[model samples]
Target: MPSTDFLWWRDGVIYQIYPRSFADSNGDGLGDLPGITARLDYLADLGIDAIWLSPIFPSPDVDFGYDVADYLAIDPRFGSLEDFDRFVAEAHRRGIRVILDLVLNHTSDQHPWFQESRKSRDNPYADWYLWRDPRPGGGPPNNWASVFGGKGWEYEPQRGQYYFHMFYKEQPDLNWRHPTVREALLDVFRFWLERGVDGFRLDVFNVYFKHPDFPDNPPRLGLRAFDRQQHIYDIDQPEMFPLLREIRQILDAYPERYAVGETFLSTPQKAARYCAPGLLHATFDFTFLHSPWRPERFLRAIQDWEQALGDDSWPTYVLNNHDNPRAATRYGRGEDDARLKVAATLLLTLRGTPFMYYGEEIGMRDIRVSRSEIKDPIGKRYWPFYKGRDGCRSPMQWDDSPHAGFTLGHPWLPVHPNYRHRNVEAQRRDAHSLLNYYRSLLRLRKENSALRRGLFQPLTFEPRRLLAYLRQDEHQTILVALNFSSRPVRLAMGRTLSAFRWRPLISTRDEPLMPRDGFLTLRGDEAVILEREA
Candidate 1:
């Protein structure tokens, strides 16, 4: 069980704010710090305990804000350092913690360290980034492909060597092998901590170190061509754990502060190691996000995580993020968007800290970006084979107005065309809207201790389309059931649970649960929370 004594984050629900798409204060068609400040009350009323703002640091927009050019300064487009201070202060006054995104795995080429490192091989900042001498023919040092595509190494004419970059060519991988480099990154963390920020969500935390010997990656047999090569030479290095310990030590100095790492490559067993005692506080589990919508699939994934992480390390759940397509697009029926709320209910009710992506509460579907409209580098390069994240990262639909009320000026990316009937304002008036459902669910989750820290055990002996689980503690045991099929299911009146009297708490329908003879019939897609009675 997680320690209940300290840290507000243990029970906190974090709402992820994709800064560029959240709001526009100055009519620049971009979200600024002040824009976020304006929405604080809306978030507070939604019952979120903390906010995880995506990157707003200075960058060249190579990959939006992932490529950091300056760690300490806020981008002029997002507002200034003073604006951040006000936002943090206002959020804290209203009882919400703020966690900033810290991207230390790589830095934009425009960064001062990268600028000087590219100049020569023996400069003071030369070792700050990964640089190696080229082969005899002067091609890239190795046969490693970047995540964006093509060779991972970029040639520098001035240094006559190849430099490593896991992302776009403009974002060079930092040399964590260098002592000065590690210290410099820690200094960046301290800069934010000293500025009164609550914590950090470390970006690409698992890719901090690579093989010191620079070994060649072996190709795989049946995996995707991209996954064909072993990542042993490039990532999931053992040394990265020690770096997390160091970061945790620094973060421990502050009060009510916590850190979560985006360590994607680690296995369920290995991922837990990053969040176990004396290391990072938490690392999100992607097992659910990666799994398809299947009863057995979800059951197995949750069980695997519990067994892997054991009882000490906490797990986090995220159904959608900026990188993936929205859950409404991926998990919901194409014609009926209300089904997406079923997913939200599942995520928010499960034990762990839940993260809701921007626009997900309102059930916003993915926007369609045509080939001519695509701006993402990955989308542009890989066209017909795979459309990039441009569709998912389009501007948020705020209301049923022009440009979805996101901006008066031209938006960086076009809003979804279906924003007419599926926006926040339209949903606010409807009693059964997705936004109100989320608000109700969130408020219920906050009020129920069992839902927050309950032990999950799935029951599989019943109907194949029925998903039922128990969240129990000594004082209370709550059963949550959902019907995934189109037909009504009469919950089997089995001998195991027939003796107990059950009281209904919340159901998708308005009627009270009839516990006559200890059996209940549920409609298609219906969900319920029941409490045991004496």
Candidate 2:
């Protein structure tokens, strides 16, 4: 089923670069488009085919850049629209595609569309947003809670109505039912597509529409009101399909354009459905992000995804992103990158496209931001108990220099203290560093067909202690074996695997796999990839 022609997205590795934390060219303590353009060489050399940037549009920073006020303009804080054009041109020159994160779910209340819509109920733009009358005597329209805090309905005093916001109040969900809203948002796609953006990573696209009835979501057990509800009626609506088809039509009008979605609060089944044929090219499944450091956990995640995306769609996978803690911080034991190397091998060799988060290759850990230093709204709202996402959204570590060489001024978020030893500059010099291991695996992935578009066949011999699988695409079959524990383990697969000769391709360990001794042993926390030799 592989296409004879080149498909950059399907075959290439997409690196997620959080604009606010990637690099800061202006010494203003913030990362910007110019900073990203300057770093293109680094990304190209890192073996990534494309870069998926987080939103850089004009925003009040309520949800960072997710609260986009204007669709066409780039935020002055992140440089102007001119800077973005240059960045795209420079990225394309380096053979690296650019994908922008589109916040299709909502727009900042500061947006002219929302501002005019809230002017009065009779205004032409009044129906642009989901405005409703208070239930009885002025409670929210329903018990639906915002993903940030309180009720999803925010009262608008001037309009004598409540508008729905799935996230913060500053961010209001657009009424997809309104034909104008649909056309306006679809035009956002065309705007960027015309600007030569290769594709889009739709932010919370699944939650774009809610049930027309506006019913109270059922209660569930959780600390925050947002998570306390089952989120049934508020998400995964039927109307999304037609809208997706329309979005697909817009993208298909352009050559080689791609679109992937971030399915907010989605399951493997729900996420996979959005990737069906013409709807979306793929959807981000965060199963790997939440997975524990165990073979059984990853095995289950892989099988569930493989089964979910079977035949109908291609899949997308991620280990970490701006909103979550880094994999190294979550799985690595006391700065040890052994666990990370093992995880990277699994991610890169898998059949689907893998998104490597910024600073992940150097194994950057989450920096703890105390209550006083917390900047993220999500973190600020859930402080003490949850601490907030500022820990994960810290600036990218570049060198041992002050502020990790991210900026001359103070970073908006604190840089991890480990930058002295863990920054990119330090790791790049170490031939056996985690950064180099990623480089090697990425190179191996490109060099091997089975590792790219292959069908996954899980090896369940040592299901709990060792994770193993075969990736076969017609020509070559690659066996990826990883020892999940801290102790060495020997492969015990039956005659099916024993029939072939495994020629070593890559390994996380210092020495390559020596399999001629009639037994294959995986050193502690090691991952090895082997190809069948004819």
Candidate 3:
């Protein structure tokens, strides 16, 4: 079982803010720390407990901010170190915790450490990165493939050797086996912790360590070249466990601090291993992110994650992020706001920490960016078949103004075309807007103890389209029902729920749903939460 003492992160909701797209305060066409500081009031109004900011460290923008050039300083495009300190202070003043994105697995090739390491074999920092001699045939050292496509090894003539990079060629994997490297990375964590960061979101955490032998991955049948191999030597090695324990020790030194890991191409069972007493507090469950809108698919994912995490572990859920397309564009094909309401209700009522991406509350869809305006390398490589992530990483739609009121200058990416009507200002005025629905759902989750920390019990129903579950505690039991189809559903309460008086608390539709003859009716794309004493 988990510790009897409660941690705020275990029960709180996290709002993910892609700093570059959130708001531009200086009219520079890019969002900055000051821009986010100005929006603290808006986030507080949304009832979020914490804000997880994506990487803001200095970078060459190869893979956006994932390729970090410096661990202790802020990117010039975003702000200075003083601006970050001010942002953290302002967020805490509003009762909102700030979580920074920590990329320890790799660094930009332009980093001083990598630059020195590539100079010569006798350099002090030569062992700081993974360096190896070429194969006997003068090709790459191994058969490992980069995630961005092509061989993972890059021939660097400077040292007459090849360097390893898992993502882009601009990012070289760090040598975690080196003690000096480990100490340097730990100091980075300490630097941010002393600066008042409440937590960290570990990026590609599972791939920090690789097999020492540098062996070739076994071939497997798959669509992508990277997926064509089993990836046994590239990631998820047993060596990661001890490193995580050391990281946990650093975080435990701080009061009420937390760390959540992002597992790349990992299963729930694999993710659970990193969340014991001395490792990560939680790991993101991607089952829901990849699942369709079908009820059975979602039910299976929830049950699988809960079972895998077991009683002693905690789970986190995310429907959309900087990498994936918006949920509204995925699930809400014909029905717009109605589908969004159901998604929000399901996210908050589920048994885990809910993470909401910015602009998701206002039914923001993925903007179609042309090839000429594309900024992401992945999208440029995939072209018409896969248009890349620029669509989802567009600027937030604040209002029906020029550039969606995100900037006075031309925004980095185009705002959604529907921003004229779908924006925070327009939705805040309407009571039935998707933004209001999200606010009410968050408020409901915060007010009800049963919804926040209660045990999850999947309720069985005959209707194949309805997804029902019960969240129960000693004081109350809340039943949540969601209709996934376009047709109405009439669900029978049966003897199990006949004894309790089910009163409607909240629903997607404007009118309240009343039970008649021990049966409840749910309209098309409707969801409801009913309360009864336990």
Best by lDDT: 3
Model 1 spans > 4 angstroms off: 1-7, 222-225, 461-463, 516-518
Question: Residue by residue across 1-534, what tens digits does model 3's lDDT show?
Answer: 122454669888999999999999899999999999998999999999999999999999999999999999999999999999999999999989999999999999999999999999998999999999999979899889999888899999999999999999899999998999999998999999999999999999999888999999999998888989998988999988998999999999999999999998878898888997889999886988899988888888888899999999988988999999889989987536787788899899998999999998898999888899899999899898888899889999999999999999989999888889989999999999999999999888887878888989877533379988899876688999899988998767777787788778899887757667787788999999999844
The better-scoring model by lDDT among 1 and 3 is 3
In model 2, the runs with Cα more than 4 Å from the true position are 1-4, 516-518
lDDT of each: 0.83, 0.88, 0.90
Q: On a 0 to 100 scale, what is the lDDT of residue 124 in model 1?
A: 98
Candidate 2 residue-wise lDDT, 1-534, digit = tens: 233655799999999988989899999999999999988998888999999999999999888889999999999999988899999999999999999999988999999999999999998899999999998876888999988888788889999999999989999999999998888888899999999999999999999899999988899899888888998898999999998998998999988999999988878999999999889999988886799887888888877888899887887878998888888888989899999999899899888899999999999898877788988877777777787788778888889999999999988888898999998898999999999999988888887878888899887643777898889988888888998898988776566677777778888876765664455788889998888887
* Candidate 1 vs 2: which has more TM-score: 2
Task: State in Å the error of residue 25, model 2.
Answer: 1.1
Top candidate when judged by TM-score against the true structure: 3
State the local distance difference test value for candidate 3.
Answer: 0.90
lDDT of 3 at 153: 92
**Candidate 1 local lDDT, 19-38, one digit each (tens):** 99888888888888998998
Give stretches of model 3 more than 4 Å off: 1-6, 461-463
- For TM-score, candidate 2 versus 3, the one ahead is 3
